[model samples]
Target: MAVNTSGRTTAVDRAYSALLAEIQTGALPAGAVLAEVEQSARLGISRTPLREALVRLAAEGFVVQQSPRVTVVAGIDEKDIRSLFELRRGLEELAVRAAAERGDAAVFTALAESFSAAATANPGLADPAAHAGYYALISAYDAAVGDAIRNDYLASALRTVHTHLVRVRQLAKDNPERLVVSAGEHALIAGAIAEGDAALAAHATHVHLHNALISILSSIAGSSQTSTEGTP
Candidate 1:
């Protein structure tokens, strides 16, 4: 229900960001109804702007329009995860390879060091503050890679995939061990890019993504089992 009163962004943009954040954080969980009038009133925005935001989310696959008036957050399952990663692996590998060929070595070297530190720190999964810092480091790494590639088209495509990825990441909230391993893998990828070794960077990216997909799927399965067992 936080409404943006700042004139910096359009009403539609503000509504979209607020709703997207809620969806990503699982506040507006999968299958949650996004009634136009209700959300518009809650967000203190007009129905027109809210509909604009919903249309944008629908295009990004974050929401589905069941009818002209009914919209809901999209559901993500194991199959959706696999499909997302399949696209991610291809795009990210290409991005890193290009970055290796064109990026500033110093930038990637610095990212490599940061990722190494994250691996060593081994932040606890239950600690929200620690996990936020860890995710910030990953975001920095992502920005570095995106800047290195210098391709708006590729970056735009990757951004779309990452939008869905934010929701998927919630499934791995309890897997601190996986985060530690992922940090190491990122360091390897950054190190390879810093050395301007295109082939190595691409290969490292592939391996990292392969391991990440496995870990994520395993985490999702474990969470599902736990929830089922706890159900009366």
Candidate 2:
């Protein structure tokens, strides 16, 4: 956190990464207002670079600026969740199919290991901090699979959607069981790809995304029902 590395990432990049990390881990909760000058002072950076970092964060769906007043943490609602998941489902299925065709054993092994670790660790209840590692592992596997596709259009689309998806993933950090389930799905898809079963890999990817969407919708529904019942 000290930015003490010997000139690797630039100051703005470091600031952006730190802010994004906090947002991803839910330290900066949804709709929290961010003061540019205050953040710059805390990070020991100038306002110019902080503003630049904030702009990048906005592009990544991590922050939103409402002119002349505040820049707040963007809150992801059900609609955004639905859109992101649907896009992820399609692109992930494509990645799975490509990885299957390529038959990448190493990629599959890495994914399998991550999933196994996630399952055994129970990051949600055991160590909430570990969930970041779990998501990073999952992202690495996804990138490997996507790379095998060799389709620029698909790859570009995936990169864009992935940024948005990460923001949505913050919602489930408090639910450790969901993380475990996600790891399981990643393993299944990885297995299918490693075995060179394109159809199965695609199907697995679809089912995985579908289940995530369903879980989110179910959470929203439960909240709605509870509110309705409590109404006077």
Candidate 3:
């Protein structure tokens, strides 16, 4: 949307947040072209700031510049998913271990309780709004771990991985069942951290990522096969 804002950095951040949300939510799906002039006008920002926002996205692999003014969203495939998880698994496992050893017990205890409530009342997640709230809880848990780990470089790397993770989650929107089980899994991780069990926390993170990767890859494989079988 158009905003009357001052400052180049503010303008760029505005454009970046708006575009990133759309891209992650499939509003600006892969292969969609972003024209500088059109986006600049629509976002009510100068072309300079829009260009800067696009450059940030491009660096994060969200988009690619085909020409001076043409940018297209990048597409993800099975290989990309596998690679992302390899990095995620390593980073998150290390993060959880650190968080368990260093995190405030009260912070993780509260989160664990929240996750327990979600696990019990997970049927509510069948609703889109409820699912959004559930994801917010996940984000809060991620931030808490980032804070607890007390490692700047690890947290910074995780921020990049999380950007693409939002888009990756869209791939399995059809499976509310998984979200139900996921709540309990997160509860285990948080509960372990609250109890200062580094091994248990790391193991929980590993299992959660393993299951998530399998589910996503299976979903992609099923969709591909369905498309192939439907071809005339």
Candidate 4:
């Protein structure tokens, strides 16, 4: 959690991003205690900025204050997954539809081509570098869609959703098959938007989300079963 003072971002922003990355990558697992004094020292920032970062994470539901002073990373369960996807489906559908209607066709077409390439690459989930590259493509696609929408309120809401989504994503990171399938799904959505087929884009987004939720839930169940079997 070493701070980079030379960077343009504020200390609070740096601390938040560092802590958030740790939480998402499971370096700080759910229920991991975050002692203010210790964390502030570890992040190489003062308590005031650290508290600001914690407050932001708490507001996003990534961490919860257990008492006046204690905070811990929040847990994710099947219910949380389902609830997340439910909100995601609605918001993403709206975003895709708006993008289809308002976005530059060439931009989405380029994204579709990129997604197709990612699918062909078929990077194994175990390779962190390759997987990160694939995720970067997805992030680019998301940014394109977000930019096209031009709705500040909707964009803000989606940002919050994505914050928690980063953590949930780890549950299915081992499933390369899902990654391939998701690539295809994103391609379809991007293609539909490129063609200005709002209805098709929305429908494709819905289908993609449904599949994603299933994959994540299945991965969670499998992991839980494995843990249970090993416990005895």
Q: Is candidate 1 or candidate 4 better by TM-score?
A: 1
Clashing pairs in 3: none
For candidate 2, give the lDDT.
Answer: 0.73
Q: Point out the higher-scoring one by lDDT: 1 or 2.
A: 1
Residue 51 displacement in candidate 3 (angstroms): 1.0
lDDT by candidate, in order shown: 0.83, 0.73, 0.83, 0.82
What is the alpha-carbon lDDT of model 4 when measured against the actual structure?
Answer: 0.82
lDDT of 1 by residue, 187-229 (tens): 9999999999999999988988888888778777766622210
Query: In candidate 3, which residue ranges exceed 4 Å CA deviation?
Result: 1-9, 67-70, 122-129, 224-232
Which parts of model 4 have CA positions greater than 4 angstroms off?
Answer: 1-7, 121-129, 225-232
lDDT of 1: 0.83
**Model 1 spans with C-alpha error above 4 angstroms:** 1-7, 122-129, 225-232
Clashes of each: 0, 1, 0, 0
Residue 52's lDDT within candidate 2 is 81
List the pairs of residues colliding in candidate 2: 124-176
